[model samples]
Target: MNGDTAALPPHRPGSTPAGTTDTSHIVQGTPAFRRTAAALFLAGFSTFGLLYTVQPLLPEFSRHFGVSAANSALALSLSTGLLAVSMLIAGLLSDRIGRRRVMVAALLASSVLSLATAMVDDWSTLLVLRTLLGIALSGVPAVGMTYLAEEMDSRALGLAMGLYIGGNAIGGMSGRLIAGIVADHWGWRWGIGVVSLIAVASTLLLWVQLPPSRHFQSRRSGLRELPARWRSLFADPGLPLLFATAFVLMGVFVTLYNYLGYHLMAPPYGLSQTVVGLIFSVYLVGTFSSAWMGQQANRYGRSRVLGICYGLIALGIALLALPWLGCMAAGIALVTFGFFGGHSVASSWVGSRAGAMRADASALYLFAYYLGSSVAGVLGGVFYTHWDWLGVCGFVGVLTVAGAAVAWRLGRRTQPATGELALSR
Candidate 1:
């Protein structure tokens, strides 16, 4: 057996070994922890890079395919909608097979599909490929979260989750920037091709670098038991709220970015595709905020940090409503910072609260997350079409306010005995 898996004695599924609790986890500062973080970071990068490569190209698609903004957005919405549904199946599959295997397969397969997407010319065919890409990519996020919660030391789990999400931030920005810039010089096809190629490289590196699962125990429970497990997760005091937060946070964030290019590319600004894509550089703030707010959550409390994130998001929206271009830029940066930080806090909270049902819980949280992305992203386009930028801002503001209320309610709840940080007073 490998040294990683050799340290722990065997135990029944869903139960910890009597005395190996601390030793079973990958502690911070150890080689295994570093390997796991590196692999997951690459996984996050590849997964999101492939998933969102088309975002910056939506206007291009609209012009080429002779579709409206909302129709062009189907390129992203279809993928996210299917991804939301597919993650549940991926979660169950991971429990039966293994988290590492599922994530590796997903990254490789999604990369290949992205390469295929770059070759397609027809509009419907492109949507079909994007939808399939969503399904293919579903294996990474939920399973990755489950793997972290199961294997990482409780004290270090927040930071691990944050790092993984930080990778997501960078991947998303790089994908958009590369695609936008390359599309200006060559075409959208070449842009997607380049991003797909990068995804393949990241996937290959992750395969070699990721250590095998050390703490995962295979569950024999099949789909028949899924309902009961999900019921239990929903019955928990905090899990449902965390899931709602995921939905609102992702929805608001995606809606803002989905329409931003359209807004800036229009009459007054007349920004080029490359310049609009460069604006996504604001996502760099997300890379910082995800890791930083997660550590803050570990110290100050998840709910308090989460609430502050929502406040920042609201402030950003207010700034975005201003007609000034610099205010809009600053607004985008603040929103990016808040959304990533909140997601980190909420996701880590789900893991801590779910206990034995972490896999299902993670899947549910992401399902809501992407579902929001699909639904609200499309709706924002409708608002933009009718009323322009203010309409979109108003729409996102409503969602942000609702999310803040959920965070406040969560703050008032008593922490469970599961070693989660207490809610800040």
Candidate 2:
């Protein structure tokens, strides 16, 4: 289930009224399209930028909190862990309320929490605020995907999704880079404060510019109706494997990044924090790869394209195990490129396969995705402490191999023996 499987879901007969006006689809080259795309881009930026603001500050956290690398990682891990669980509920909540309202409130509330996080002196209090930020963020990502799937023209949907993900890549990069550099000059709190202020602007753009949802009709289904839809989503042939891919992919990526700062800061490469921050600019490659690879998947098949990406991820991990700085940078860039490309393809695949349950499918994928980040990210620190970079690489390597195996199985199931071809809508 790939390629033209990216097509939109058909309208339910009794649900949408006659003469409701077919102005729902915001196709390319229209004013509504421009506004909606820009608004979502800002939404993507705010959500990720706020969430990852503390990533590069991990070492500083260890120093200040007097904690081990594993303990310091809790700042990000706990947030992601909570965010993953909240996503399950947030999607269903959006079904009851409207998409636009949930997204706007999520952004605004999360931004405020981020700002508050900068001021807390108590370590426990800081963690509490970070946890809340995760719950607040749950409203945006899954709902945003559902909103785009509902409102955008089928032909232009791929590009719309790519742009939003590109925004995520840039936001993640900028947050890490800016925080590291600023922290080196001033303090970690100041670094976090700056990123929060930027997120405030991003929130305003999403609130003011996003066109209200014309396509979303409120679903009155309560908690009782969720189990049936959950069963349907899991039973789909393509979706379960895709969710596993999400978990493994994020696990590998976050594990490497979570500990790389520590490795680069110690003995052989005692790089300054600012320089360390500059290295995360590798995310620019991801910004380009996601859009480009998504286009390739549209022409070729997602299954064929995705396996190659998994191979690239493994190759990158191998490079990181080497002892050269240049080699490490190259490895990180490769990993970033492959990660964004595979994520773009796989995430779009979930929407394609879900039919009408776009929000639930997206929520499931993100839930696994963030869960991997929380679990594997913290585990990486333990490996680093015991056996250094080799152990860390070994852990990530195993996950990548498993991801490749799953990708191969998915490809075989989705493609015919005659030739690889796009799935019909």
Which predicted model would earn the best TM-score?
1
lDDT of 1 by residue, 75-103 (tens): 99999999999999999888878888898
lDDT tens digits, residues 1-425, model 2? 11111234455422547778554577877998889889888888788889888989999999988989998888999899999999888988888878888888898899899999999888889989999999999999988888888788766677788878888899889999999999999999999999999998888778788886656777777778878988998887778889999999999998898889999999989999999899889999988988888888888888878888998998999999999998999999999999999988888888777767878899999999999999999999999999998999999999999999989888776532112236411
lDDT of 1 at 319: 97
For model 1, the stretches where C-alpha displacement exceeds 4 angstroms are 1-7, 11-21, 421-425
Mark the 10 consecutive residues where model 2 has the least summed lDDT: 416-425
Root-mean-square deviation per candidate = 2.2, 5.0
Residue 416 Cα positional deviation in candidate 2, in Å, after optimal superposition: 10
Top candidate on lDDT is 1
TM-score of each: 0.96, 0.93
* Local distance difference test, candidate 1: 0.90
